[model samples]
Target: MASDYWDRYFRRARRMRTSRRRFLLGSATVGIGAAGLGLVGCGDDDEEEPTATSEPGETPDPTATSEPGETPDPTATARPEETPQPTATATEAPPDTSAVPTDGSYYSQVGEPFVGITLDIHRGVSGIAGGVEGSAYSGLIRFDDIPAPTFRGDLARHLPEQPDAVTYIFDLRDDVVWHDKAPTNGRPFTMDDVRWNLDRQLTRTLADGTVADDFTLTNTVFTHIDSLDYVNDETISFTLKQPRGTWLESLAFAGFMDQGVAEQIESDPDVISADRIVGTGGYMFTEFVPDGRRIAERHPNWHLRQAGEEVQYFDALALLDVGADVNAVRIALEQKQVDWIGGRFQRQAYAPEFMQAIQDANSDIERLDVPALNANRALIYSWEIGPFSNPMIRQAFYLALDRQLVLQQDFAGEGRITGPLPWAFTDWALSEEEILQQPGYALNKDDDLQEARQLWEAGGGEDLEDNIELVANEPDAVRLSEWFTAMMNGNLGTDKIEVKGIPGGSILPYLTGEDPIAFLTPVSAWTSPDPRQRLARSYTTAGSINFGKYSNPGMDDLFDQAAATLDRDEAISAMKDIQRLAMTESGAGTILMAAATGRFLKWPYLKMEFNPWRLPVDERSWIDQSDPTFSGRPSL
Candidate 1:
C-alpha cells in the first residue's frame, strides 16, 4: 500500500513538472499566520517548550455571543444571576475608540460567522485556552490583524510591517458573541481578561499541566509591563511597558485567556464537557469518543474570511483520530473513513511505502508533508558519568564513531547527521571548525584512539577493563550504539565498554543519576528560538528537563546571558559560546551533532515545508492543506 502511494506521488510529480510553477521550498515562516490568528504560545507546559506569543493578554471569550457557536443581543441586559457582581462599572471609565470604525456594517461584512475544522490532536489539550479554563469569554475587540513577530517597531494601525518599538494596542470588538449567552458574566471580557490571565499563570495552581515558564513570569527582562483599562462600553486599551519585539506573537500564546471566559468555566465545568467544547476558532466541538472518533462542525456565528474574496472556504470540518500508527492512517485513508490525515500521523514512520500507497490509490489524494521545525533526533551524552565525565574521553568517543557508516547502515541512508543544530536550520548553524573546537566535537578516529589510550595509561594502566554502559531509545540508536561499542572495544580492548539499548521512554529513570552513565538520550523540546531552553535544560543543575543533571557554571552563565538579553544577535552569540563550552569542556554533554532521518512520498499538489526547530503544533506547514482549492489535487 505504501509503495502504491509513492508510485502515485511520482506520477503526480512528473505530471506537475509540465506546468506547475510553485516548487516545494521545504521551509517557510510560520510566525506570520500564527501571529495573525493570535494563536502563539505554548499550548501546554509538560508537552512543549516556552515560545513567544503576540501579547501576554486576555483569554478567548467564552460568552455564547463572543464565541463561535452562539450569538447574543448586544443590547440585552444581564440579570444578577447571569453574571458575577460587578466590582465596579468599568465602562464608566470611558475608553477612546475614535480611531475605530463606528459603523456596525463593517463587522457584518467580514462574511461567514464561522468555518469548522477537525484536527487529530496527538495529545489532549490541558483544558485552558490560555491560562483560564474553557469557559472564559470575550468578543473580538480591535484585533491586531497581522501575523506574529512581524510588527516589531511601528505604532501604526491595521498590522504594521514593523513598529518603531514593541508596543501594540487593541480595542475589543462590539456585538461579539460568546459560547455561553450571558452579558453580566464578568463584563463581557474587557481589559480585565488580559490582566487576569497573566495573573492566573503567575499566581494560580491548577491540576492542569499548562503552566507558564517560570522565567517568563519571574524574569524582569521577559516580563510584559502593560496596562489594561476599559475605555467605553465596547472598547478597552492595552499599552506595553517595554519594546516587546514579539508582542503579536506573544498574544497567540496558549496562556493568554479572557478573564470573563475563565470565570464561567471555573464557576461551572458542566457548562463544557469532553464532547461539547468551546472556542473562538472556526469549529465547535460536536463530539469526542476518546480512541474512537471526534467530530466538530462549523459554528454559525464564527468570524472568518476567505483568502481572495470575503467568504469562508470550509463549511465544516470533521477531524478523526483513528490511531497514532501510520499503518492505521493508511487503512483509514484507503477506506475513506477520514477526511484528511491529522498532524499526529505526519511522522517519518510513514516511510516511502505508506505515502506511495496513498498516491497510487487516488489521483485526488495528495500528501501534505510539512517538515517540522525541530531537531528530530539528537545525540546527547551524559556528562556526569565514569568515562564521559572527562572531556578527553568524551571527545574520543565522538571522534571514534563512524557517522557515515551509521547513517547508511542503521538509518538506511535516509537520516541526516550534522552538528548540534539540525541541517534545515542553516542560518544559526556553526561551522565544522567551530564544532571541532567544542570539547568533544572532534571525531578524529586515529588521533582520538591514541588520546584515549594515553588517558587510560595516565589515569591508571593499560590492563584496565572498566565495563561501561551505552544507552539510547530507538532501533537506529541501538544499532549505532552497538557499532560504536564494537569500535571502542576493538580499539581500546574488551574490558572497557559494554553497550545497552533501551526504549526511548524507559531510558528516563536511568538518566536521572540511576546509572553511572548513558549516551544519546532523548528529550523533547518545549519551544524554539529560545537558546536558554537547550542550554539550561541540558547543562544546568536547575534545568527541570535536564536528564543528565550535567552542571557547569560557565555554560550556565552563557545560558543566562542569552536568556536575559532581548537582542537576537547577542543571544545567537551566547548560544554559540555555550555550544563551544559544552562540546569542548564536557560542561553538560558533548553532542556528536544531531541527526534526523525520514522519507516522505512526494506528490505534485503536496508541498513540504520543514521547520526542524518549531514546536510540534506548528507542523501545519504541510501541503497548504488549508487552501480550499487543494482538495489533494495538483494544479494544471
Candidate 2:
C-alpha cells in the first residue's frame, strides 16, 4: 500500500518538474502537507546517492513501547519488545511559588541576568494574525535569570518530545490557570481544543468561499491535519499520514498556536479582545495592547526547578512588537523604550559604533547563538520563467557568481555556501567533497562564458532577450541584491542579463508563487541534529517549510520507509538518503550566515537552550531579587 502511494506521488512530481520552476504563493494556494511545519532539505550537490538499507529484517511489532529506564539509540535497528509508560498527560504540576523572587528588589541592569533589548522590529499583523485579531505581537520567551533544563521545566506543558521521526504524544496537566476570572480560566485543557485548531487549518476557507491555501505542502507530507483524537481530556493523540521524525523538535517554533486561545477564537472569532490570556503556561497574561505589547507575569503556580529542586524565583514576560527595524532598535535601546530584541536585524545597521556606545556606557549586553535549520540565503530564480527558465541560462548565472567573492565582499567573509542543510548545529553536515560526489552537485563556481553563450543561443536568449529583477526587504538584503545585480550585469555580457532591485515585502508575493520572475526571499530555519524531521519537512508534500517546492518520487519513498522502520539504524539510513536528495538541487539557495542573539544584562541566573527554531524562555531562566546578582545600573 505504501509503495503504491509512493508511486503516485512520484508521478505527480514528474509533472511538476516538466515546468522549469513552480511559483508558490500565499495561504490561498500555499500547501503545507500533514507533517506540520518542520524544516527539511538535502545536501548542496545535485547527485548524492541515497543511504544504504539493511537486508530483510522483520519489521518491528507496533504493539509494544520501549522499556522504561532504557534510552533507545536513535540509529539502532533492533526494535524493543516492551513498551515504555504511555504518556498519559501532556501537562505537569506547577512548581511551589513560595520560593520566587520579589520583583522590586532585583537590579535592573541589562546582562545575562537582567538584560534589556530594544525590540522595534515588527511586521504588520493584518490577515496573518491567526486568532489574535489585528493585534501585531512578536513572540518572546526570554527568562533572564534562570538557565536551560530549568527553563525547560516552567514550560513543561508546551515542549513535546522527539522519541523518533514518527510518533508524538502529549499528556495534559490539570493544575495550570489563566490570569483572568473568565469562565475559560483554569479549565482543564482538553483534546477537543487541539483537534479543533488542527481541523480549522484543514478546513480553512476564504471569505470568498474558496479553500484557504495552505503553504507547507508543496514538498512535504504535512497536512493541516491527518487524524486528531483525544484519548481523554488530559491526553491527546495525533496520527500523521506520514512518519515525521522531527515533529517533536519542531514544537520549539515560537508561533505554534495555543489550544485554549484558539478555542476561544472559535467560540467568538474575536476572543483576543481580553487584555488577559488564558494559556496553561507558566506566565499569566497581565496586559495586551494590540500592535504594541503584551505582558505575561510569571504564574506563581509554575512547576519547575534546578536539578529536581523547586525553582527559587520567577519574573514576568513581555511581548513588544516593534517593527523589527534596525534604526528603531537603536533608538529604542538608547531611549530605554524596550529591553531585548531578536530576529533577523541587518548586521550593518548594528554597526560597531552602535555596539561600542552601548558597551562603553556600561550597558549590560551579551550576544546569543542558537542553531537553526535554514538553507543559505539565495538568489532563487524561477527556472520556469524568463531567461532563468532555461537550464543553460541558470547555469550561466551560477558561473557569473564568484560565491567566495560575494561572501567576502557582501558578508565580510562571514558566510558559507552550504548545501541544503544549515551547518552550525551538526558536525557531519555534507562537506564540499561530499557535495561533489553527489550526482547533481555544482561541479565548480568557475564562469564559463562559452557555455553561457552556447546555452543562451540554444535557448533563444539571443532573440527573446531577458533581464533579471532583483528584490530585497531590509537594508542588508538590498545591499546583497545590488551586489548580485552588479555581478550579473558585469559578467553576463551585453544584452544578456540586466538586474533591477525590488522591495523586500515584494519577495513574499514571489514566494507565494506569484509572478514567474522575481528573486526569492532567504528561507530560514534552525537545523535539527536528526534528519527525520528535516527530511519530512523537505520531502512531504504538505510541509510548509519546503519553500523551493522540489519533489521527487524516489526521495519520498525512501522517507516513508525511514519513517516506518521503528529501528534506529534503518531510519538513519533512510534519513541520509533524504539529506542527499535535498543537497543535489543546489537551487538558488545560499547559507549566508548563522547568528547569535545579543543580550545586555546584569543577573547571572540566566541560561538558554537553542530550539534552533527560536529561544525557549520561561520562569526557570530568571533570577529573583533574592539572588546576589541584582546590582543597580547608572541611568543613561
- Kindly list the per-residue Cα lDDT of model 2 for residues 1-636, writing each as its tens digit: 222322343333344224221111011100001122321112111111111110110010011111114333445453488554697543434443223433322111111111111111111111222211111121111122111111121223432343544444566544433333364544544455445534444455323355544423222323523666667766655566665433332232222234445444434544343332344444555555555555555545443332243332335444455554656665555444443333221111233344455556643443332221232344544444555666665655555555555534433433344555444323335555675454323435343545555555676655653455555444444455456566655555545454444444444555556465544333433322344545355445544444444456676787667655545556655555666655444343222222112222211323322232222343223433332323342222
Write the residue-wise lDDT of candidate 1 on 268-376 in tens digits. 5444333334444433445444334344443345333211212222333333555556677666555444434322123223344546568787665544432122313
Best by TM-score: 1
Top candidate (lDDT): 1
| TM-scores of the candidates in the order shown | 0.61, 0.59
Model 2 ranges off by over 4 Å: 1-180, 185-242, 249-276, 303-313, 320-349, 360-364, 367-376, 432-464, 468-482, 491-495, 503-515, 518-520, 525-551, 558-611, 624-629, 633-636
Superposition TM-score, candidate 1 onto the true structure:
0.61
